[model samples]
Target: MEAPSFLDFIIHVTGLPGYLVFSWFMILVIISLALIVRSSLKLMPEGIQNVAESVVYGIYSFVEDILGKEETPKHFPLLATLAIVIFFYNIVELIPGFIPPTSNLNTTLSMALIVFLYYQFLGFKRHGIKYIKHFMGPVWWLVPLILPIEIIGHFARIVSLSVRLFGNIFGDDLLLAVVFFLAPWLVPLPVMALVLLAASIQAFIFFLLSTLYIADAINEAH
Candidate 1:
Protein backbone atom coordinates (compact mmCIF):
# COMPACT_ATOMS: atom_id res chain seq x y z
CA MET A 1 0.00 0.00 0.00
CA GLU A 2 1.20 3.48 -0.87
CA ALA A 3 1.42 6.29 1.65
CA PRO A 4 -1.24 8.94 1.26
CA SER A 5 -0.25 12.03 -0.74
CA PHE A 6 0.19 15.40 0.89
CA LEU A 7 -3.23 16.67 -0.21
CA ASP A 8 -5.00 13.58 1.02
CA PHE A 9 -3.00 13.62 4.23
CA ILE A 10 -3.97 17.21 4.91
CA ILE A 11 -7.61 16.57 4.07
CA HIS A 12 -7.93 14.78 7.37
CA VAL A 13 -5.04 16.18 9.34
CA THR A 14 -5.62 19.93 9.64
CA GLY A 15 -8.92 19.52 11.47
CA LEU A 16 -10.84 21.63 8.99
CA PRO A 17 -8.57 21.25 5.99
CA GLY A 18 -11.70 20.63 3.95
CA TYR A 19 -14.32 22.89 5.39
CA LEU A 20 -17.34 20.99 4.16
CA VAL A 21 -16.16 17.61 5.39
CA PHE A 22 -14.84 18.70 8.72
CA SER A 23 -17.60 21.18 9.27
CA TRP A 24 -20.22 18.59 8.56
CA PHE A 25 -18.50 16.08 10.78
CA MET A 26 -18.20 18.47 13.67
CA ILE A 27 -21.71 19.86 13.23
CA LEU A 28 -23.28 16.46 13.18
CA VAL A 29 -21.47 15.44 16.31
CA ILE A 30 -22.27 18.71 18.01
CA ILE A 31 -25.94 18.62 17.07
CA SER A 32 -26.25 15.04 18.16
CA LEU A 33 -24.64 15.84 21.45
CA ALA A 34 -26.81 18.90 21.85
CA LEU A 35 -30.00 17.06 21.02
CA ILE A 36 -29.08 14.31 23.43
CA VAL A 37 -28.35 16.79 26.16
CA ARG A 38 -31.58 18.66 25.47
CA SER A 39 -33.72 15.55 25.65
CA SER A 40 -31.98 14.39 28.75
CA LEU A 41 -32.60 17.71 30.42
CA LYS A 42 -36.32 17.48 29.75
CA LEU A 43 -36.84 14.02 31.24
CA MET A 44 -36.61 12.55 34.72
CA PRO A 45 -33.18 12.05 36.22
CA GLU A 46 -31.32 8.82 35.59
CA GLY A 47 -28.32 7.41 33.78
CA ILE A 48 -26.64 10.12 31.70
CA GLN A 49 -28.94 12.78 33.14
CA ASN A 50 -27.09 12.69 36.39
CA VAL A 51 -23.81 12.87 34.58
CA ALA A 52 -25.03 15.74 32.43
CA GLU A 53 -26.39 17.53 35.49
CA SER A 54 -23.08 17.18 37.22
CA VAL A 55 -21.15 18.55 34.25
CA VAL A 56 -23.55 21.42 33.59
CA TYR A 57 -23.76 22.42 37.23
CA GLY A 58 -20.01 22.10 37.66
CA ILE A 59 -19.33 24.26 34.61
CA TYR A 60 -21.86 26.87 35.77
CA SER A 61 -20.35 26.95 39.24
CA PHE A 62 -16.86 27.13 37.83
CA VAL A 63 -17.67 29.97 35.47
CA GLU A 64 -19.59 31.86 38.16
CA ASP A 65 -16.76 31.45 40.62
CA ILE A 66 -14.30 32.89 38.16
CA LEU A 67 -16.35 35.48 36.27
CA GLY A 68 -19.22 36.19 38.73
CA LYS A 69 -22.73 34.76 38.47
CA GLU A 70 -24.20 37.68 36.60
CA GLU A 71 -21.40 37.48 34.04
CA THR A 72 -21.36 33.69 34.08
CA PRO A 73 -24.76 33.07 32.48
CA LYS A 74 -24.28 35.71 29.82
CA HIS A 75 -20.63 35.09 29.04
CA PHE A 76 -20.75 31.35 29.43
CA PRO A 77 -22.41 30.70 26.11
CA LEU A 78 -19.06 31.14 24.42
CA LEU A 79 -17.09 29.84 27.35
CA ALA A 80 -19.23 26.74 27.53
CA THR A 81 -18.84 26.33 23.79
CA LEU A 82 -15.04 26.41 23.89
CA ALA A 83 -15.00 23.95 26.73
CA ILE A 84 -17.29 21.39 25.06
CA VAL A 85 -15.88 21.61 21.55
CA ILE A 86 -12.30 21.38 22.76
CA PHE A 87 -12.87 18.54 25.19
CA PHE A 88 -14.57 16.49 22.50
CA TYR A 89 -11.91 17.28 19.93
CA ASN A 90 -9.20 16.37 22.40
CA ILE A 91 -10.79 13.04 23.11
CA VAL A 92 -11.00 12.27 19.39
CA GLU A 93 -7.52 10.83 19.68
CA LEU A 94 -9.01 7.82 21.42
CA ILE A 95 -11.16 6.90 18.44
CA PRO A 96 -9.57 4.64 15.87
CA GLY A 97 -8.66 6.40 12.61
CA PHE A 98 -9.62 9.77 14.06
CA ILE A 99 -7.07 12.42 14.98
CA PRO A 100 -7.43 15.15 17.57
CA PRO A 101 -8.17 18.35 15.67
CA THR A 102 -6.46 20.44 18.33
CA SER A 103 -3.18 18.73 17.44
CA ASN A 104 -2.99 20.60 14.16
CA LEU A 105 -1.62 24.13 14.01
CA ASN A 106 -4.22 25.32 11.53
CA THR A 107 -7.13 24.22 13.71
CA THR A 108 -5.57 25.59 16.85
CA LEU A 109 -4.74 28.78 15.02
CA SER A 110 -8.33 29.10 13.88
CA MET A 111 -9.57 28.61 17.42
CA ALA A 112 -7.06 31.19 18.67
CA LEU A 113 -8.09 33.66 16.02
CA ILE A 114 -11.77 33.13 16.78
CA VAL A 115 -11.24 33.82 20.46
CA PHE A 116 -9.06 36.81 19.58
CA LEU A 117 -11.76 38.27 17.39
CA TYR A 118 -14.39 37.63 20.03
CA TYR A 119 -12.59 39.51 22.80
CA GLN A 120 -11.83 42.36 20.45
CA PHE A 121 -15.43 42.53 19.36
CA LEU A 122 -16.63 42.46 22.93
CA GLY A 123 -14.20 45.26 23.78
CA PHE A 124 -15.59 47.38 21.01
CA LYS A 125 -19.11 46.65 22.14
CA ARG A 126 -18.17 47.64 25.65
CA HIS A 127 -16.00 50.64 24.82
CA GLY A 128 -16.62 51.66 21.20
CA ILE A 129 -13.67 53.69 19.84
CA LYS A 130 -12.42 54.04 23.36
CA TYR A 131 -11.19 50.47 23.06
CA ILE A 132 -8.34 51.79 20.99
CA LYS A 133 -7.17 53.59 24.07
CA HIS A 134 -6.01 50.26 25.40
CA PHE A 135 -3.26 50.21 22.85
CA MET A 136 -2.29 53.83 23.56
CA GLY A 137 -1.61 53.20 27.24
CA PRO A 138 -1.58 56.01 29.82
CA VAL A 139 0.22 58.94 28.18
CA TRP A 140 -0.09 60.45 24.70
CA TRP A 141 3.65 61.12 24.16
CA LEU A 142 4.46 57.45 24.88
CA VAL A 143 2.15 56.34 22.03
CA PRO A 144 5.01 55.77 19.57
CA LEU A 145 6.83 53.34 21.83
CA ILE A 146 3.72 51.74 23.30
CA LEU A 147 1.71 51.29 20.09
CA PRO A 148 4.12 48.87 18.48
CA ILE A 149 4.56 46.98 21.73
CA GLU A 150 0.81 46.69 22.09
CA ILE A 151 0.41 45.52 18.51
CA ILE A 152 3.05 42.87 19.02
CA GLY A 153 1.46 41.83 22.25
CA HIS A 154 -1.96 41.43 20.63
CA PHE A 155 -0.54 39.36 17.75
CA ALA A 156 1.45 37.27 20.19
CA ARG A 157 -1.84 36.35 21.84
CA ILE A 158 -2.75 34.26 18.79
CA VAL A 159 0.63 32.49 18.69
CA SER A 160 0.72 31.72 22.40
CA LEU A 161 -2.85 30.45 22.62
CA SER A 162 -2.60 28.24 19.54
CA VAL A 163 0.80 26.72 20.30
CA ARG A 164 0.12 26.02 23.96
CA LEU A 165 -3.04 24.02 23.21
CA PHE A 166 -1.56 22.18 20.24
CA GLY A 167 1.62 21.23 22.03
CA ASN A 168 -0.13 19.91 25.14
CA ILE A 169 -2.72 17.80 23.31
CA PHE A 170 -0.28 16.47 20.75
CA GLY A 171 2.32 15.59 23.37
CA ASP A 172 -0.16 13.89 25.68
CA ASP A 173 -1.69 11.78 22.92
CA LEU A 174 1.67 10.78 21.51
CA LEU A 175 2.97 9.72 24.89
CA LEU A 176 -0.10 7.60 25.51
CA ALA A 177 0.33 5.77 22.20
CA VAL A 178 3.94 5.03 22.95
CA VAL A 179 3.15 3.77 26.41
CA PHE A 180 0.33 1.57 25.19
CA PHE A 181 2.51 0.01 22.52
CA LEU A 182 5.36 -0.75 24.88
CA ALA A 183 3.35 -2.13 27.76
CA PRO A 184 0.17 -3.20 25.93
CA TRP A 185 -1.41 -4.05 29.24
CA LEU A 186 -2.67 -2.59 32.53
CA VAL A 187 -0.05 0.16 32.70
CA PRO A 188 -1.55 2.29 29.93
CA LEU A 189 -4.91 2.23 31.68
CA PRO A 190 -3.81 4.59 34.40
CA VAL A 191 -2.14 6.82 31.86
CA MET A 192 -5.30 6.81 29.78
CA ALA A 193 -7.21 8.13 32.77
CA LEU A 194 -4.60 10.84 33.02
CA VAL A 195 -5.28 11.72 29.40
CA LEU A 196 -8.96 12.27 30.26
CA LEU A 197 -8.00 14.47 33.19
CA ALA A 198 -5.55 16.38 31.03
CA ALA A 199 -8.27 16.88 28.43
CA SER A 200 -10.63 18.41 31.03
CA ILE A 201 -7.91 20.59 32.52
CA GLN A 202 -6.83 21.87 29.14
CA ALA A 203 -10.42 22.75 28.26
CA PHE A 204 -10.97 24.54 31.57
CA ILE A 205 -7.73 26.46 31.25
CA PHE A 206 -8.60 27.59 27.74
CA PHE A 207 -12.03 28.78 28.81
CA LEU A 208 -10.64 30.48 31.92
CA LEU A 209 -7.91 32.29 30.04
CA SER A 210 -10.32 33.43 27.35
CA THR A 211 -12.62 34.82 30.05
CA LEU A 212 -9.71 36.68 31.60
CA TYR A 213 -8.87 38.16 28.21
CA ILE A 214 -12.43 39.41 27.84
CA ALA A 215 -12.41 40.71 31.41
CA ASP A 216 -9.14 42.55 30.81
CA ALA A 217 -10.56 44.21 27.74
CA ILE A 218 -13.47 45.54 29.77
CA ASN A 219 -11.27 46.49 32.70
CA GLU A 220 -8.93 48.48 30.46
CA ALA A 221 -11.76 50.59 29.11
CA HIS A 222 -12.36 51.87 32.65
Candidate 2:
Protein backbone atom coordinates (compact mmCIF):
# COMPACT_ATOMS: atom_id res chain seq x y z
CA MET A 1 0.00 0.00 0.00
CA GLU A 2 1.21 3.49 -0.79
CA ALA A 3 1.63 5.99 2.03
CA PRO A 4 -0.83 8.87 2.10
CA SER A 5 0.36 12.45 1.71
CA PHE A 6 -0.94 15.46 3.63
CA LEU A 7 -2.42 16.85 0.44
CA ASP A 8 -4.27 13.63 -0.17
CA PHE A 9 -5.68 13.65 3.33
CA ILE A 10 -6.59 17.32 3.17
CA ILE A 11 -8.23 17.03 -0.23
CA HIS A 12 -10.18 14.05 0.99
CA VAL A 13 -11.71 16.04 3.85
CA THR A 14 -11.57 19.69 2.85
CA GLY A 15 -10.85 19.76 -0.90
CA LEU A 16 -7.58 21.63 -0.48
CA PRO A 17 -4.19 20.23 -1.39
CA GLY A 18 -1.89 23.18 -0.87
CA TYR A 19 -1.22 22.44 2.78
CA LEU A 20 2.27 21.15 3.56
CA VAL A 21 4.44 19.95 6.42
CA PHE A 22 5.37 23.50 7.28
CA SER A 23 1.70 24.24 7.79
CA TRP A 24 1.54 21.40 10.24
CA PHE A 25 4.55 22.68 12.07
CA MET A 26 3.12 26.19 12.06
CA ILE A 27 -0.06 24.94 13.68
CA LEU A 28 1.91 23.00 16.25
CA VAL A 29 4.06 26.01 16.99
CA ILE A 30 1.04 28.23 17.46
CA ILE A 31 -0.68 25.84 19.80
CA SER A 32 2.47 25.20 21.77
CA LEU A 33 3.28 28.88 22.00
CA ALA A 34 -0.18 29.70 23.25
CA LEU A 35 -0.02 27.00 25.87
CA ILE A 36 3.39 28.02 27.08
CA VAL A 37 2.46 31.69 27.29
CA ARG A 38 -0.73 30.91 29.11
CA SER A 39 1.06 28.64 31.53
CA SER A 40 3.77 31.16 32.11
CA LEU A 41 1.16 33.71 33.13
CA LYS A 42 -0.45 31.54 35.76
CA LEU A 43 -0.62 32.78 39.35
CA MET A 44 1.87 30.18 40.51
CA PRO A 45 4.75 28.93 38.40
CA GLU A 46 5.24 25.19 38.34
CA GLY A 47 6.46 22.52 35.98
CA ILE A 48 5.94 23.80 32.40
CA GLN A 49 5.35 27.30 33.73
CA ASN A 50 8.68 27.29 35.50
CA VAL A 51 10.47 26.05 32.42
CA ALA A 52 8.72 28.61 30.26
CA GLU A 53 9.62 31.45 32.63
CA SER A 54 13.26 30.43 32.64
CA VAL A 55 13.35 30.31 28.87
CA VAL A 56 11.63 33.69 28.59
CA TYR A 57 13.96 35.20 31.16
CA GLY A 58 16.99 33.92 29.30
CA ILE A 59 15.71 35.27 25.99
CA TYR A 60 14.81 38.62 27.58
CA SER A 61 18.26 38.89 29.12
CA PHE A 62 19.87 38.07 25.81
CA VAL A 63 17.77 40.66 24.02
CA GLU A 64 18.45 43.22 26.76
CA ASP A 65 22.15 42.88 26.11
CA ILE A 66 21.65 43.88 22.48
CA LEU A 67 18.58 46.14 22.57
CA GLY A 68 18.90 47.41 26.15
CA LYS A 69 16.16 47.33 28.84
CA GLU A 70 13.82 49.85 27.26
CA GLU A 71 14.02 48.34 23.79
CA THR A 72 13.96 44.77 25.03
CA PRO A 73 10.35 44.98 26.16
CA LYS A 74 9.27 46.38 22.83
CA HIS A 75 10.99 43.65 20.83
CA PHE A 76 10.87 40.77 23.26
CA PRO A 77 7.76 39.19 21.75
CA LEU A 78 9.29 38.42 18.36
CA LEU A 79 12.72 37.58 19.69
CA ALA A 80 11.45 35.32 22.41
CA THR A 81 8.90 33.56 20.20
CA LEU A 82 11.53 32.90 17.55
CA ALA A 83 13.97 31.45 20.06
CA ILE A 84 11.38 29.23 21.70
CA VAL A 85 9.82 27.88 18.51
CA ILE A 86 13.16 27.33 16.82
CA PHE A 87 14.51 25.57 19.88
CA PHE A 88 11.40 23.37 20.09
CA TYR A 89 11.65 22.39 16.43
CA ASN A 90 15.35 21.77 16.83
CA ILE A 91 14.67 19.48 19.74
CA VAL A 92 12.05 17.68 17.69
CA GLU A 93 14.67 17.11 15.01
CA LEU A 94 16.58 14.87 17.38
CA ILE A 95 13.77 12.39 17.75
CA PRO A 96 13.62 9.30 15.59
CA GLY A 97 11.38 9.68 12.50
CA PHE A 98 11.13 13.44 13.04
CA ILE A 99 12.81 16.36 11.32
CA PRO A 100 12.76 20.02 12.28
CA PRO A 101 10.44 22.18 10.23
CA THR A 102 13.29 24.70 10.12
CA SER A 103 15.34 22.15 8.17
CA ASN A 104 13.10 23.11 5.26
CA LEU A 105 13.88 26.26 3.30
CA ASN A 106 10.20 27.16 3.20
CA THR A 107 9.95 27.45 6.96
CA THR A 108 13.25 29.26 7.48
CA LEU A 109 12.60 31.65 4.61
CA SER A 110 9.16 32.45 5.99
CA MET A 111 10.69 33.15 9.38
CA ALA A 112 13.41 35.34 7.90
CA LEU A 113 10.84 37.28 5.93
CA ILE A 114 8.85 37.89 9.12
CA VAL A 115 11.94 39.21 10.91
CA PHE A 116 12.84 41.36 7.91
CA LEU A 117 9.40 42.93 7.57
CA TYR A 118 8.97 43.36 11.32
CA TYR A 119 12.19 45.31 11.87
CA GLN A 120 11.57 47.45 8.81
CA PHE A 121 8.10 48.23 10.08
CA LEU A 122 9.45 49.14 13.49
CA GLY A 123 12.12 51.34 11.92
CA PHE A 124 9.62 53.28 9.84
CA LYS A 125 7.21 53.50 12.74
CA ARG A 126 9.77 54.78 15.19
CA HIS A 127 11.58 57.17 12.85
CA GLY A 128 8.57 58.29 10.80
CA ILE A 129 9.83 59.82 7.50
CA LYS A 130 13.42 59.73 8.72
CA TYR A 131 13.80 55.97 8.37
CA ILE A 132 14.70 56.46 4.72
CA LYS A 133 17.33 58.95 5.74
CA HIS A 134 19.38 56.21 7.36
CA PHE A 135 20.07 54.65 3.99
CA MET A 136 21.27 58.05 2.76
CA GLY A 137 24.65 58.65 4.32
CA PRO A 138 25.67 61.83 6.16
CA VAL A 139 26.97 63.50 3.03
CA TRP A 140 24.20 64.70 0.72
CA TRP A 141 26.05 63.57 -2.40
CA LEU A 142 26.65 60.11 -0.93
CA VAL A 143 22.91 59.41 -0.55
CA PRO A 144 22.60 58.02 -4.07
CA LEU A 145 25.55 55.67 -3.61
CA ILE A 146 24.72 54.60 -0.07
CA LEU A 147 21.02 53.96 -0.71
CA PRO A 148 21.41 50.96 -3.03
CA ILE A 149 24.14 49.45 -0.90
CA GLU A 150 21.97 49.73 2.22
CA ILE A 151 18.95 48.27 0.43
CA ILE A 152 21.00 45.33 -0.85
CA GLY A 153 22.45 44.75 2.59
CA HIS A 154 18.98 44.72 4.16
CA PHE A 155 17.61 42.23 1.66
CA ALA A 156 20.73 40.12 2.01
CA ARG A 157 19.85 39.67 5.68
CA ILE A 158 16.78 37.61 4.74
CA VAL A 159 18.87 35.33 2.58
CA SER A 160 21.63 35.06 5.18
CA LEU A 161 19.28 34.26 8.06
CA SER A 162 17.27 31.70 6.11
CA VAL A 163 20.29 29.97 4.59
CA ARG A 164 22.23 29.89 7.86
CA LEU A 165 19.38 28.18 9.74
CA PHE A 166 18.36 25.79 6.96
CA GLY A 167 21.95 24.80 6.24
CA ASN A 168 22.86 24.00 9.83
CA ILE A 169 19.71 22.06 10.78
CA PHE A 170 19.51 20.25 7.45
CA GLY A 171 23.17 19.35 7.59
CA ASP A 172 22.75 17.97 11.07
CA ASP A 173 19.70 16.01 10.00
CA LEU A 174 21.50 14.60 6.99
CA LEU A 175 24.55 13.60 8.98
CA LEU A 176 22.47 11.93 11.67
CA ALA A 177 20.52 10.01 9.05
CA VAL A 178 23.70 8.73 7.42
CA VAL A 179 25.22 7.70 10.71
CA PHE A 180 22.08 5.96 11.92
CA PHE A 181 21.77 4.08 8.67
CA LEU A 182 25.37 2.93 8.70
CA ALA A 183 26.13 2.36 12.35
CA PRO A 184 22.90 2.58 14.36
CA TRP A 185 24.90 2.13 17.51
CA LEU A 186 27.55 3.71 19.73
CA VAL A 187 29.02 5.67 16.84
CA PRO A 188 25.78 7.62 16.39
CA LEU A 189 25.51 8.52 20.06
CA PRO A 190 28.16 11.22 20.06
CA VAL A 191 26.85 12.59 16.79
CA MET A 192 23.39 12.92 18.30
CA ALA A 193 24.83 14.78 21.26
CA LEU A 194 26.69 17.12 18.93
CA VAL A 195 23.56 17.70 16.86
CA LEU A 196 21.66 18.65 20.02
CA LEU A 197 24.35 21.18 20.81
CA ALA A 198 24.23 22.47 17.26
CA ALA A 199 20.48 22.88 17.50
CA SER A 200 20.79 25.01 20.63
CA ILE A 201 23.61 27.09 19.15
CA GLN A 202 21.77 27.66 15.87
CA ALA A 203 18.66 28.79 17.72
CA PHE A 204 20.73 31.26 19.77
CA ILE A 205 22.54 32.49 16.67
CA PHE A 206 19.23 33.13 14.95
CA PHE A 207 17.93 35.01 17.97
CA LEU A 208 21.14 37.03 18.38
CA LEU A 209 21.23 38.14 14.76
CA SER A 210 17.53 38.98 14.83
CA THR A 211 18.00 41.09 17.96
CA LEU A 212 20.88 42.95 16.31
CA TYR A 213 18.79 43.60 13.21
CA ILE A 214 15.93 45.00 15.27
CA ALA A 215 18.35 47.10 17.30
CA ASP A 216 19.86 48.61 14.17
CA ALA A 217 16.42 49.33 12.81
CA ILE A 218 15.20 51.18 15.89
CA ASN A 219 18.49 52.75 16.87
CA GLU A 220 18.05 56.51 17.45
CA ALA A 221 21.25 57.56 15.68
CA HIS A 222 20.61 55.19 12.81
Among these predictions, the greatest lDDT belongs to 2
lDDT (0 to 1) per candidate: 0.76, 0.80
Candidate 1 runs further than 4 Å off: 1-27, 42-44, 220-222
In model 2, where is the ten-residue run with the lowest total lDDT? Answer: 1-10
Give lDDT tens digits, candidate 2, residues 1-222.
111364345547775433245346556766887677795677878777777778778888878988888888888988888887888777666766665678888888999999999999999999998899878877889888999998999999999999999999999888877877888886456888899999999999998899999988898754
Report the Cα lDDT for residue 38, model 2: 93
| Clashes (N, CA, C under 3 Å) per candidate | 0, 0
lDDT of 1: 0.76
Query: What's the CA error at residue 15 for candidate 1, in Å?
Result: 13
Which candidate number would show the highest TM-score if scored against the true structure? Answer: 2
Model 1 C-alpha lDDT per residue in residues 74-138, reported as the tens digit of each score: 78878778888888888766653456778777777888898899889888988899999999978
> What's model 2's overall lDDT?
0.80
Worst 10 residues of 1 by lDDT: 1-10
